[model samples]
Target: MLTDRTDTRAKLWRTASVQRGYFTAAQAKDAGYSYQAQRYHTQHGNWLQVDRAIYRFREFVDLPAEGDEQLVRWSLWSKGRAAVSHATALTMHDLGTASPSRIHMTVPRNFRQQTDALILHRAELTEGDVEERVGYRVTTPLRALVECAAVGEDQNALDIAIAKALSQGLVTQPKLLYAAQQVGPRAELGVERALAAAS
Candidate 1:
């Protein structure tokens, strides 16, 4: 009969904390709380709604305190259909000086998420484009740079990314050239120059 009220409350707290300040209504239902109980918790200041169907711990609700919220937001966005990219990826790779104000993520063209914290775009990626970081999947440094070069307006950023990737030995000159070719004219000159330097 699920009559252990104390045990249920403890489980809810543990579940919410484990998710790092985020919970969904569906998760609450699965955890044996009614929709009304979920609302009651929110109204009582035990939980705070961070987004539609997303709740967070009232004490740690600041979205920009660190990159963790961005990761969580990305995970909740589009069935986790997002991967870090652009300046964010450059930061992760330690390949640039720019600190993006928002988390950059790539999703399919048809996917949508209801948040402004993410700079979302559409692109296709292969398995080689992704890497695992901090237990979360993200675009590899090389692939992210190429993606940035392919779409970004600034060529110098792409040049720096290429140089950084080469300096780190994270990618070979030939591979960079191939990726540049794939992205077309936007990246061709940068890739060619980087390749020449590497050779």
Candidate 2:
């Protein structure tokens, strides 16, 4: 029979598994770890303190795939309001070879987190504009390509994303057309140009 402590550890482990080993103080509290207990765990090497109120379980760090940890961490840092986006979203969807120098994210207008590694955009995302990753969300392929084009990220990156998405059956041209229509003229033109480039 599982003791109360074992039950709590199981619950926190479930959350940490999805998040690639990271969790917030609030989450630890939810899993029944008091602040003092958290401090003890960190001191004993069971948890590694990451940022203020953020932590990583030592065993779980070796568990994530490449390129996803930063996204997961920043999304947690935003308390889950931020979506990995723009060129970063394109890469998340495996549509490009881009290794962006900065992590681009879109957050709700009221959200704020300043960091040298992050390029944050303020916007409230519609459900269709975002997709779920294991522990975080990312902008949809259509939104990502359009956003990159709108901000003049890189023409070739847009072209490659659209082309690869279409080729992999990840998106259809009609779906792309609908997404372009939703974003309005400048973005529509941008999507069209990339679609043309892809074809």
Candidate 3:
């Protein structure tokens, strides 16, 4: 029989548990932990500081795998305003053999976070362009393919990503074409080549 306060703590722990036991300072505040309380937890070794603004509960115990560490940390860094995008989104959607060394994220044009571990693309994302995966937000497969082809310099990689998306029925050629058209001339050439190869 847990008391009300204990139940609140447990609820917060459960929320962070899904995200590799990681939570942001904002989340702590929302869960009724004051700034002083957060510091107290850190000082007492009850919570581990994972990044500049991210903390992990000592007992939450849901560690991320090797490849997911960077993505998870950067996701926390975004504080939910960014969605995984471009090559990283392609990898998340399993649409290509892309192994991006840096995490790619799409933030609104006014987003202001500056970090070295992430490549930021400023875009106005609509609801249809993003999806939640596990506890992270990512661009949809169709949007990811268009983004990869639009900005990616490597034609070979774009070809493979586009082909994978089409073969897997993740997106159709018209969807790619529409997305590319939305980007206008910046994406025309890549989308043309990708369409040819995928079709």
Candidate 4:
């Protein structure tokens, strides 16, 4: 490595350190690494590729690849274009016993990228519907249940999630009802049933 590049690499390392050791290709470029240099570094094991266009410092590459760390890495890979949502948000908020087999995220309608690890739902979210938590953004609890109610597969699980959220004071019946109605009539059934059971 060139001596001059050391400072640039240090800056990139500082950024990646805050993001749980993940940095994107664009971030690397911004930190003065050309595509060729990035490839060389990764090829030489100075950085470890996490996903396409995403890399983690080789020093931190040995960290376990599950739970919140990986979730933060995945979110960084999205380039702030997605917010965790639905069942994943419920799990993050500790509102359910059921764990989703895949992470759930919402991207703007025009955003495109498909991957096996995440189920991406496309919609524009209102500012109030999203909240930042643990260095990443997620849907508000009521919006999470509302989105889950709209497309979630299991009524029993959804009800349990709602009950838990209610008990935890994460959301209220009126707010859930309002969120459901905002998504239209089809979504109302699940929230209504969950509310009934909780009552």
Candidate 5:
């Protein structure tokens, strides 16, 4: 019986080592560790809990190195309503020079979170608001620029986003004007300028 238990532990360790950093409880269970065994492994220093049902190996692994930490965090934070946007969307579009302090995502009206790292906004997003970019589902560059123009209090940021979209030829003048009209007068100049440049 002791040998059998040891074999299970060894198997779990080998499965975890290959993953290197993180695994969910479901994943651990799928890898052959029973719930009680998984708990025992945690108590014995084999796994560390990062969040509810999320586990990582005991040794520290580089979260940034994997390039999917944000995805993992997003998955944990309710994947349905969250879509990367604003300056983070700019970064994803490779159109601007700003580094957003936190992951900028928009959630539905009812979503909430405990951390400030997630800037949750209550908004309605349709299929039109989302697009595939660099293999990830994100707000389209044109849509994100318009969104920034509409909601961003910083005129400079709005101008930059509009300019970038225009310079890249992603939005035409008529479309820009139409979008600005939808947002109101505050966004008119930036949208007009972007449209002119795109023409």
Candidate 6:
């Protein structure tokens, strides 16, 4: 039989793998790590305390995080239910000039993580609307544009993004139209207007 320590290590390892080597105190507790033990591990160099109640396996601590490290930590912060969206996603997909002051993410309507660093929107995204990245998720170009337009992202910027996406095949015209129609009148109007200007 595995010792208690071995069993706990295995459980935490499994949890961290899906989270890009990061795990929360709650998760550690659920995996049989008591609060005191968590402190001990951190003190002993077994786990890196990354943020408030957040820990990372030293193995996956360093990464290509220069621009994206925080994205992973925040993804873990959301417990893995958020996808980079809105202006942040548009920037990631290289579709728009939406350099918002804050990062953006889409979570379930009930997900209420409040922080000044992020702008959280609520929506149920279809699988096709999200693209999985190294340690986080982001909205597809088509979805990002529709979302930005629905929220009244600047018209000229949306137009530029739409034109760029279409030219580079990041989003097809028909697909953009269908997605816009699904969003509502504003999105549909924005997409149609952009398409007309482009064509």
Best by lDDT: 6
Higher-ranked by TM-score: 3 or 6: 3
- Model 4, 1-199: lDDT tens per residue? 5547888898898888878788899999989899999999999989989888999897776777546676777788678878999989888888757778888999999987778888999999989999985547899988999998999548898889999888888888888898899997767999998888878
- The Cα local distance difference test for each model comes to 0.71, 0.84, 0.81, 0.85, 0.65, 0.87
* Candidate 1: residue 9 lDDT (0-100): 64
lDDT tens digits by residue: candidate 1, 16-49: 6655666677777777889898889889988888
Q: List pairs with backbone clashes in candidate 6.
A: none
TM-score of each: 0.79, 0.88, 0.88, 0.90, 0.66, 0.82
Instruction: Give the winner by TM-score.
Output: 4
Q: Flag regions of model 2 displaced more than 4 Å.
A: 1-3
TM-score of 2: 0.88
> What residue pairs are clashing in model 2?
none
lDDT of 2: 0.84
Per-model C-alpha RMSD: 3.2, 2.5, 2.6, 2.3, 5.2, 2.7
Worst 10 residues of 1 by lDDT: 68-77
TM-score, candidate 6, is 0.82
Taking all chains together, the TM-score of candidate 1 against the true structure is 0.79
- Where does candidate 1 stray beyond 4 Å? 3-19, 59-66, 114-116, 134-136, 194-199
Clash numbers, per candidate: 0, 0, 0, 0, 1, 0
lDDT assessment of candidate 3:
0.81
